[model samples]
Target: MARTRPRPRPVATGCLMGRLRGNPWAILCVLSLAYFMAQLDISVLTVAVPDITRDLHTSFDRVAWALGSYVLALAVTLITAGRLGDLYGRRRVFRAGVVLFTLSSLVAGLTTTVDQLIAARALQGLGAALLIPQTMALLVEAFPVARRGTALGVRGTVGAAAAVVGPLVSGLLVTVLDWRWVFFVNVPVGTALLLATVLVPDDDRAPGPARLDVVGTLLVSVSLFCFAFAVSQGERYGWRGWFWGLVALSAVAFAVFLRQQRRRQSGDPLVPFELFRDRDYALMNVVSVCVSLAFMGLVLVLSVFFQSVLAFSALKAGLAIVPAALCSMVFGTVAGRLSDRLPAKYLLLAGTGLTVAGMLWTAAGMHEGADWPRFVAPLSVIGVGNAFLFTPLAAVGLRGLRPELAGAASGVLVTTLQIGSMIGTALSGALLGGGAGSGPTAASSRSAMVLFAVVAALAAPACAASSRTPRAGGTGDRAPDEDAGRAAAGRSPCREPRPSGPGRGQGGVPR
Candidate 1:
């Protein structure tokens, strides 16, 4: 009987491993969850800003930096973090990011001072930057070309969902507990994300070790920080001389960074120019930025208007906005499926156009006597538009890119989004006269909505200019710039057959 003690169930264990490795859906689920956490953190603290200022006994200016600091750090680090994933392994970097994010959230929750909170938030941003690119790269790797659009659609929907839900969750937490619990909430979610990493197979890095572009990194980091800080703080500082100086410095640094990147193209550049060789990818970056700018700005304006102008409580304001999120969720599922069958450009055009109309409708409704009920229809319209917008943008924008360029392309795309969001937030805040004792005037709210409408309208042109995405069950899945991408990497022009065996190669394509 002792000898009959069962050996470890090797066959069962093997099957489990086999299923984990073979399943792309499992990978998508894990990546989507992690992405949701990153996105949720970005907006969750908006409702808590005033609470934080009161609790920490900090001036509004200092407390505001907590938000700006996180965004600045994230924007500055994203490109470098993506390249790091290329140099190292994506799954490994993703795990590291999860750990850093969780720990920083703990620190943020415990912090008693504005300085501590800002620092912790900055760390959280850095962690987010590290992992975000990997989600796109890994999704591309796990799914075949035929299903890639659907997968990206799902990821986009998750991001959109998380973003809209953040304020609702924050309002709930702050109402029941303290404001610090907004940060505290991430700890458990991040821990679960860490555990979920087991389902994400390790991504294959480049064949050889490549040195990071130290100078380019410094230059870009400085440029992004200076630009972001200048815009975010300009109104608070009364558009002082130093603000203009920072803007000038940012412009110079960015110009120099571009020049250096051009020179270093033969070597390892911080931003791979090869990514922009695909016309759709380049235009998509523009669309992504415009969309984020319009959306984030509108959210900021509406959130403040609801609480201060309508005199709703934080929780009530969040509830008022829930219809938009719910509508987006419902339509997003439809958009995802459609992306697989339709040309993404058409969807993008329709999405942006609808968003523009919705914003204008919403702006018209923003009057002195407005109630939450007046917003439901317009917000739902915007929600449906948003669902159509991002899924196709991601699916089409990234379609023709070389798998190897996934991280870099993702970084650039997301960096544009971050920069756009920062700009939108800052501009809307200035328009609202956030520092004024009185709340936003009806005129100011309407003006902000108009600004958002204008910005969203810009994406339509870019979408129209994009290359057509290959439809599933129709044309072949040949990337438009496949040969050009190979040549840019100094590979031979002769096409290498895609591997389909159990063995995997760089970027996790099967070999």
Candidate 2:
């Protein structure tokens, strides 16, 4: 006697709408608040470097470590944290991260010694690494395909806004109160977010029976940490034996990680090799890394130039970035909406061109006594370009991932972003220090800006290459796997898979 299959439940639009309508933005708000706290810690602390150095009797290098440690930790653990979320549950990991981060923030604020603060900041980074990927996974799971662009647009806008607002908020607090307030501020916000997260429903998606690649995780962590450390300390150590030794170790670790990944191709790899089979996804990853590097480097140099070279107050320097931030928010939202209607390639190309143009403008216009308007327009233009670039790249990167690997892909993407930022900060800082003696006045800053402009110019070719690929799910046909599932559920059999490679069945569906 054959058993009858379970009946497929009808998808009720009213029920779906009802479930979503009850504070749908709650999750986004929680994630955004956490993100804002992290950004604030990084940016705000930079402005308080002098005060920290004076109070703690620390050198510039030690103070720099306070920021670098957090960045390095975040980059190293990002992919690992994402895998953890996939193995357990994103909601659980996210809540854990929030609790850890809030506690770490409190510890950081109370720390008396520099070493204690550095350790606290590193802990905060660990929390951020766990929190970030889950946010992306949650967003994808919470929103329907039709509304995803809007949701992501809001996410991008909030991140950009935080980048702008963090410095200003930090400046005000540092000037009026003390540097400890920067970390202390996260406590209340984090507490509120933690409470709100309990209301957001969990995604009930089934998890795959994949083992965590512990060896791969260790190798990747060592490689990234060594690389970040070498870059961060390169100027002090120079190209001496110790520096080269670290670089060599990093190279060896990278080689080992690649070999391990290749060995586990048939099994569940830490980072699935199959994910890179799609040329568009591969190129987008490259673009994402490069774009982040350029943006972070430019911002670092510009902030320093405005403060140290131009003698602007911390508050004034923070406010200087506001025009660009506001413009980026507006354009990002508009571009996200347009991406739903237009090809992502066009938006990327246009954004890349604008970015290049803005960088060129900065390189040309920056001078000791440059008018505010000249800098403002270029900054705003760059922000607009970034707005266009970020959302579409995000939309494109995860466009055709399988549901099972969505969390992993999101982790990879966010990891690249943080890694790129770390590299950018290190490289840009090196350029500033290296070029310090080349001239008097703000010449070093100008030279560093030129380096950033060169990087921005390179993005155009990458964007052009990306624009040539066809959009995901453009074949207008469902895959064989989806068809089989539909038939099993008693729905009419869907169309056959697109005539592509073996992995094509899982490649077209947006995770």
lDDT of candidates 1 onward, in order:
0.81, 0.73
TM-score of 2: 0.86
Task: Indicate the worst ten consecutive residues by lDDT in candidate 2.
Answer: 495-504
Q: Which tens-of-lDDT digit does each residue in 1-511 have in candidate 1? A: 0011221221223544443542567778889989999999999988888889998998878987898778888898998888777666778888998999899999999998899999999999999999898898778766766567777888888888788889999989998999989988889989988987876655544436467889999999999989988987787787899999999999999999999999999888889897787788889899988999999998888888888788888888888888778878788878877887887888898889888998999999998879999999999999899989988777687777666667777888899988888888878878896675755988899999998899999999899988665432211244448657867876433323222224554323434
**lDDT per residue as tens, model 2, 185-258:** 88998898787775455543345566678999999999988887887677665656887788899999999999
**Candidate 1, pairs of clashing residues:** none
For candidate 1, give the lDDT. 0.81
Candidate 1: where are CA atoms >4 Å away? 1-18, 434-438, 470-511
Highest TM-score: give the candidate number.
1
lDDT of 2 at 461: 68
* TM-score for candidate 1, residues paired by index: 0.89
State the number of backbone clashes in model 2.
0
